[model samples]
Target: MNLLKKRWLLLTAACVINLCAGSIYAWSVFAPPLAERLSLITGTAVTAGSLAAAFSLANGIAPIPMILGGWINDRFGPRAIIPAGGIVMGLGFYLAATAVTPLELILGYGLGFGLGLGLVYGSSVNTTLKFFPDHRGLAGGIATAVYGLSSVILPPVAHALIETEGIEAALLTLGGVFAIVIVAGGLLLEKCPDAFAKQFTAAAPGKQMAAEECDWRGMLRSTRFPPMVALMLCGAIPGMMIISHCWSLAKDVVGLDAAAASAMVSMLALANVFGRLLVGALSDKFGRLASLSGALILTILATVLLSLSDQNAHLLFSAGILAIGLSFGAFMGIYPGFTAEEFGAKNNSVNYGIMFSGFSVAGFAGPMAMNMLKEAGMSYQTICLLAGTLAILGLGFAYLFVRAKKAAYS
Candidate 1:
């Protein structure tokens, strides 16, 4: 087959593999059952709060392996790294299934699964970007949208499995499936051909061409890097805050019952998927920074709406959640292509992994800020207002990023 057809096939394979890898988001489904099982095994009360550390560790430690995986992908191609990561991820699930204590669960799911997720996720995204230099935004959008959507798709299935087969069987069954699918996808992937970029220019018809190649170190040294990180952090904070607490927020602030709150979570996830696709395509036509700036503006509006929402304003609450979801998804969709455009695709695997540190920071900070403010006797409205203020600051950082990009690139 021709290169065009082959690349498209690889893209399909990447998406399928990412679907399995994205099962990390299904942790919410797993957490409760897993906690009950562990409680039974250890003869102690294992609450979800007790497992929060493991969840935090899982996310916090991923960047380390992601950086290593990206380096390997850049040097050795994705085939080996993808399969290896998949195996490790599966092993994590298997180990978690048999865990007798909280520490074991942390070791199994937290360190093991988190590390493998970083590897597979980073490799899949970077490989997809490498093949689609001419359509980076769209390709990135599709890849990440699938990843984000996995939560919606997997939760119901996982719940059913947990109900029918029990937690251990459910975990084992899912792990085996993830391993087999990822390995199959890995076999189909190949390195991007050297001539591919030359055959199709690095930009879409009206978009600016990509910058010259820069390794991770060079990218870090660039004047644009700091503001770029700040921009990502700013965009991610409110998104993470809302995402981490959406169900609770729906119940507490909007006065929804359990069922209605669950529906709101699904709505936010759908909006996230749509945002990724919409903004990603728009970035191709308009520009990455412009798209990101627009998203930030949406963030500001969303948070403001959220601040004003009360028990009587369910409609406003829903709208706020939808807008935040879209803006967050836009940020997630735009960054991979944005990083490639600014730094060059050659080192994108490592470079984008580094750029993702901003996200990791936001992940920790957003939730911590929310919890802290709540503990300080602040109302939900006060917290929402604070998030809106942060969005405004994010816009300032976006301007700085734009100026830095011009000064560095021009």
Candidate 2:
């Protein structure tokens, strides 16, 4: 049909491809089983805690490949880059299936899978943002919401597969499926036309203003970049901290049982998905900065609620968890469109990838801070209060970001 019709098809493909690539979030399902298999094979004690370094590597190394993938996607279009990424991801799983040592697992799943994930994830998001300039927030929200939802949806299926087929066979099966879906989806995508925005403007008389194009180098040099990164980091820290330790918080601090603690995890994931969808649409109408400010407020309030919550106050604890999930999801949803709006979409793939480095930093800092403080005999209440203080500082940074954006763009 027409190019317009083709874009919708491409959007569908991107969603499907993202669904597969997002399975990386379900790494928790594989961790214990994989660790056990490694222990048996290597005749050494391989705890899940020991295997966590590989998981950390998988997340920590993604930004490097994302930048590289974004560069390729910007130049050559997503069609080739996406399939290539899928192939590498599949190869990683294949290698992981044969791993006899922790190093091999790290190389295969950590480095290899992480590299492929960065490529595919960046391509899908960039492509979606390019095609839907008129609906960037909603488009990005849907893309990331599905990505976040993978952890919720895949865990049960992955657990079942591991139980029946064994970890190696399950890895092989899932890897093959992920590759086929991503490759097929990639084939359906095409680059956005140069005049696409002009066409939208012509069709809709009162649409948002056309974005000002800025290359990656110019974007990095801009006055707005630093504050924007700082705002993102601040917004992300509480979410990362809560997500990494929610189960422990639920169990040890809130005194939740096994089933209830598991439910808290599911609730957080669901809230995350809802937040991505809701804040994304709302930001389109309410403005990104305002929506972000609201999210930060919610984060601060959540932290306070959590700090005050105890075993006798399950409702308060649940509310705190829900709020953190929503606020965190809002940050994830807002940033893609916000980056494009601030720096422009022409170089968005690379620019957003660079912007995402803030998230990587938050990922490490949030969890490490929580773990260290807890190890040093700090109370959960004290930790939550500290997180709240960080959110307050983030709110200040958000104001700085707004000011910087206006000064630069105006």
Candidate 3:
């Protein structure tokens, strides 16, 4: 179907697959059903936060396979694996749907599904970058933006499936649908048109033109990396906390019941989509550090709102979430864009594969941080306050980076 001819179709597929691959954010939606089915609770048999932790761990660890996936793509091409990921991801969901116990949920959805997600997720960026090499940021922005949009699309559907058919049936049906998608979408990923790769690599000027040429060895040696990892961790905490505590906050802080709380989660998901795209494209205009700074400031404000109110919390929460989500989106967009801008995309998959584990690291850290805080008798208010403060600290780091950038030029 001449996918390149219909660029829109390709974009749609990319967006769909990307977003769907990211539905890991929607893990919270399953917690209620999963918990109910197993008769567990937050501090009891199971914690939604812990499950989220597991998912983040998987996502962080995803880059490992992505590194391998990129190598495979560079060799055999992308077609077969992407779709296989989709199928496996679906099966993960299916496992979640069918799970009667925690073990199945962890192994099936967390491990198996996560592996599929990792495989396709990184490839999507690599694929989109190749497709629109000229607009790498835009491609990465939109495709990467799906990180949050995944939550927007699936959690509600998952919520409904849980509410309607029960988790088991939902798992079965969704898995079946995914099996078909994997087979179909995987086919399109088969080959990178030689013209595209050739034209792309040829367009670069010197060992200096595009920031995409480097051996994996050089990439591993860069000392400029730690700050980037720090930026990602700082950005991830509150955003993840919001995700982990979506329902709980809506219930406790906002005074919403289950249905209403879920609805708010949906709203957060919607905002997340907007945030990812907006922050990313904005980076192209304003520069990466500025975008990061803006997001950090916004995160601080959002956390403030999050710390305030009960039933009257909705409006403030909305404002705070917008900032938090956008900051998060920016983080996703900026990291890949920054990596490519700094090191070049030649070893992008490999470098990012290693670096990308930060997400999982954040995922692991985020929940543990929050849970520890909570267990230490820290209120959500305390956690929100600290997370927001960290955002400010991140802003300082971004400021320093910008200063360094300016210094290099002068």
Candidate 4:
């Protein structure tokens, strides 16, 4: 195939792999069911928070494997590692299906799923970035957008499986299908050609790129890195919180039934997908910092509105979902491109892996905070208010980064 065709194929394959890998996001659907099942089997009450630990722990554990996957992919191609990720992910779901204890659930879903996710996610995203250097934001967005889209497509099926066949069957079925699809995509995946890789070094006229061929260590040494990490952490917490706990919130706060809760999850995913695509394209047209600033501002507003919504105010709640989801997806869409712009695309796999550790931290911290605060007698609105505050904190970092960008380009 020609270069353009090959790149497009690779992008398509990456998207497919990500779609399968992102089954982890459907944890909201599984959390209540899994908790109920465990409670029934063990004859003890189980909290969604306890089960959510698996999800939080999964995100926490992912950073180590993410760094490993990136380093390996930097040296070797993605074919082997990506396929291995699929196998590992399948094994995780299989384990979850048979799990009767909380520990087993944690090991299966937390370590197994998290490790597999880390392995595949960075490789897929970096591969796309390498392929479309000129449109890094759009390319990265397209890849991650599919990951977000998984939430849109999978929750209803998962809900149906849990309702009809039970959670075990749901886990087993999803696992099997994901493994096959991811493996196929991994096999079909390709790195950018040498010609395309070379073009990445060539910048548009009068556009001064700050970082060029900068290694991870050098990138870390720069002042910009710290603020970026802070921005990512703060920006991600609210979204991760919502994603991990949305079902519970819908049931408890919105007083929605199972079907409605499932619908809420789908709505969140739809908004997320829209944001991913829109934010990436907007960043390409505008600037990454500008796009991030706008998203963060939106997050702050949406979070407050969500906090204020009562059970009767479903429309207000849905609006909050859409707004928060949009900001969440926007962050994911823009950050890969931002990493490449600031750190340098030459070492992007490793650099982004390191930068992504912030997200990993946020992912875990968000869920942990929610569950912990809930246990401590915090209201849902109180938690959301905290989340909104964090978004405000993120905006501060966004401003700093924008200033830094101006100084670099000036």
Best by TM-score: 1
Rank candidates by lDDT, best first: 1, 2, 4, 3
Candidate 1 worst ten-residue window by lDDT: 200-209
Total residue pair clashes for candidate 4: 0
Off by over 4 Å in 1: 202-206
lDDT of 4 at 153: 78
TM-score for each predicted model, relative to the true structure:
0.97, 0.96, 0.81, 0.86
Evaluate residue 88 in candidate 4 and report its C-alpha lDDT on the 0 to 100 scale.
89
Q: Model 2: clashing residue pairs?
A: none
Model 4 regions more than 4 Å off: 28-51, 159-170, 200-210, 241-262, 307-315, 368-386, 403-410
What residue pairs clash in candidate 3, if any at all? Answer: 60-360, 79-189, 79-190, 97-168, 211-344, 212-344, 212-345, 302-320
Better of 2 and 4 by TM-score: 2
Where is the poorest 10-residue window by lDDT in model 2?
Answer: 202-211
Which candidate, 1 or 4, has the higher lDDT?
1
What lDDT is obtained when candidate 2 is compared to the true structure?
0.86
Across residues 41-141, which tens digit of lDDT does each residue of candidate 1 receive?
A: 88889987788777788788888888899998887889969999999899989988999998899888998789888999889988988888777888898
User: What's the residue-level lDDT of 307 in candidate 2?
Assistant: 93
Report lDDT per candidate.
Answer: 0.88, 0.86, 0.68, 0.84
Worst 10 residues of 4 by lDDT: 201-210
Judge candidate 4 against the unseen true structure and give its global Cα lDDT, from 0 to 1.
0.84
